[model samples]
Target: MIDKKTYNEIGVHIPSILLPKEGIDMQKWSVVACDQYTSEPEYWEEVEKKVGDNPSTLHLIFPEIYLEHGNADERIKRINNEMKRYINEGILVSQKPCMLLVDRSTPHTKSRKGLILAVDLEKYDYSAGSQTLIRATEGTVIERLPPRVKIRENAILELPHVMLLIDDPDKTVIEPLAGKLDSFEKVYDFELMMNGGHIRGYRIDDGETLKGILKAIEALADPEVFKSKYKVGDDKGVLLFAVGDGNHSLASAKVHWENVKKSLSEAEVEDHPARFALVEVVNVHDDGIVFEPIHRVLFNIEPESVLNALQDFFGSSCCSLEKFDSLESVNKRLSELKREEAVHSFGFVTDRSFGVFTVQNLKHNLEVATLQGFLDYYLGKQKEAKVDYIHGEDVVTKLGSKPGNIGFYLPSMEKHDLFKTVILDGVLPRKTFSMGEAEEKRFYLECRKIVKD
Candidate 1:
């Protein structure tokens, strides 16, 4: 409900929990975004133990682990209460109108630096083939929007762990603002607890630097140049921003705003804060950003069952090899398989040992694009094919080695071809390339109120 003029003029005056320059004990002060590690409860448990009673960000935010619990409603109530408490108690302070400069370092030795500012929702759109100012790099999942809507509905404040990506590999937008850092005041600088690494922030009050960023964004948004950059036709609109992560969160905002718009007029509709979602936009070409492959683990299915499934999916040409006893052997075999050969491999595991299965001539809709869709179609018919998307090969091996489980490893998406592929062809399949691994994920820190006055 926030308009561009007001959004740019006053911006959203949301409060944030500021860390002192003396340096925060980051291990306790910084926590992973609530949505990460949803399938891994142990990680969250460790975080809880590490952040115990430390006035941590953990207390201020709700972990998605509690999403299914009975106390979820109560926890959300507490979150809203805490937002008011943090503001009323002066635990969070307000800054003069400006963009917040942030430097984030992950546990994986990668660092991302950017500015936190409110983007006008009016300029954003998420429809397919949308030339809207904002777009999704991968297809947005419509099914995941409801729970997020419920989470943000009554909240007094919204905290973002979402990172948006722009193709500014030349360090054009964010780097120039660093020179003016001395002109702005320092807001937060601390170490994130539990190996999240370090984070620092400065508030930019100078109109000149902010205007420069606006100009850069304007250039990227320019219709002709934008189309040429993507090599699309002149009639096509420019798709400048992409939802690198937190697609659901942004979709939830869109859903909530559409629902709220029924009773309000055009003018009144622009006043609500729910219109804009908070996100950190990083350059896709930023050296710190890496695209990792998301591997799959099928749980509670026996090794023989996996073999049988593969054989059934690929027909009589499928073959099983029990000699692939080591992880390296399986990797070497899988890497050598050609995409055009219609052959695929899987690592099967049981409580006692691990083995491998190689399938050939699997009937797939589009060999490269619909791997998950085909799996979903086949798995939907079977009772034991429970799949989990995982981040690292180590996790894949560990999970697949568990009782009644198997793992399928996929190749990583080529980063250079992502935008072109999406522009030429439609969006890629969901659960595609991960921006970074689990710990390197965007953390919840900056916030913007979607409701406007």
Candidate 2:
């Protein structure tokens, strides 16, 4: 169990984790993060069919794709009630205080490792230019929090999909834990549904192991060590943790904590369950973690008008387009272009044509940034047009081929540049990049109580 001193020192706590009882179907009990599959309602429909009348995380969390479909109030009520039911019926049994070490194996990527623990929200800040030890890697959209807040405010438990990144280049913290897995107890080992992946978790409750983990985290956070690693000046603020995924959820937790803390006394606030949010901290340099670019797909817009706007926005000198005969051609050219040059470029697939667009004398460090700037302005004028941040290039090709839709394929950003970029330039634009494909995202496996009993 983690003590108050460790919590204060590392801003992490060993949680009273809740897991499915031994008899329950583990595959049905777990689900992907709710925020995923926003553009694909059919995916959620399959999940609903699979989890029919069974106790599942799907019942506890609201999928964002359905956010605008109405009946949200009723859904929230049911979600909260289900949480109470799950706890009261012993479907979710409480475990001893410990951190969970997760090994996630997906078909497309290497096995990813993560450590799950409750992060103290008191030490986190997601607003612009936050210098807190835990910082957000992308800008938080304040407007996106209301729906999430509505779901979380009355919810009894939290099952996190939030992934935290520590810039541990030498693999000191989580790597060492892998060697000591035999000393800990195995918790859950099963295959995820809908071809998501296989996941296995082990409990880390040993006192000596816990202390060593905390010590390593402290070393990473040491100011001298941080400065030397980043080669930054002495006056620069230290950033120990970066929110790699689920920044909005973490921000929402912070918001809810801020609102609820007003009613608590100093003593009551010290170890409040709501004050800590559960997240998996993974090293940014982990071999298994792959950073993939989030491409854009615009709907309800004419392809010709989009092309015209792009040409006008960037002008003849800076912007140019080269046509390709097919999606395969576009993909082949993009693959080659990625290797040949450092120029800002994006591959596009529309109903009218397949092509690559290049922007010389780029304004931002990333091609996504330059494209996003234009799209923001273009969409403002073309009010009927809507944009969705997509994951894979193949998805973009398929979706953008539909009439009145266009997709922009962006190249992946270097994972190594994440922390340094966020520290130097504040947060990157929203929907900048994804840690992996949709299926590789963290599943909602473990739950923790947010309301004190």
Candidate number achieving the greatest TM-score relative to the actual structure? 2
Using lDDT as the measure, which candidate wins? Answer: 2
lDDT of each: 0.67, 0.89
lDDT of 2 at 124: 95
Worst 10 residues of 1 by lDDT: 12-21
**Cα deviation in Å at residue 68, candidate 1?**
2.8
Give the C-alpha miss distance for residue 333 in model 1, angstroms: 2.4
Per-residue accuracy of model 1 over 1-453 as CA lDDT, tens digit each = 223453343223222323322343545656888877766889999988987876456776778767778787788777788767665665555555567878877777556776676555666666667656676666776766777777777776777776777777567888776677677787777777556677778887665666667667666666777676777887665666777777667777777777767878888866566666667777787777788887777776666665566556555555556546677876676666544465655454455555555655565322234357546765787765677778877887788778777766666777667666666665667677787787777777655555552
Q: What is the lDDT of candidate 1?
A: 0.67
Candidate 1 segments exceeding 4 Å error = 1-27, 316-323, 338-368, 383-385
lDDT score, candidate 2 = 0.89
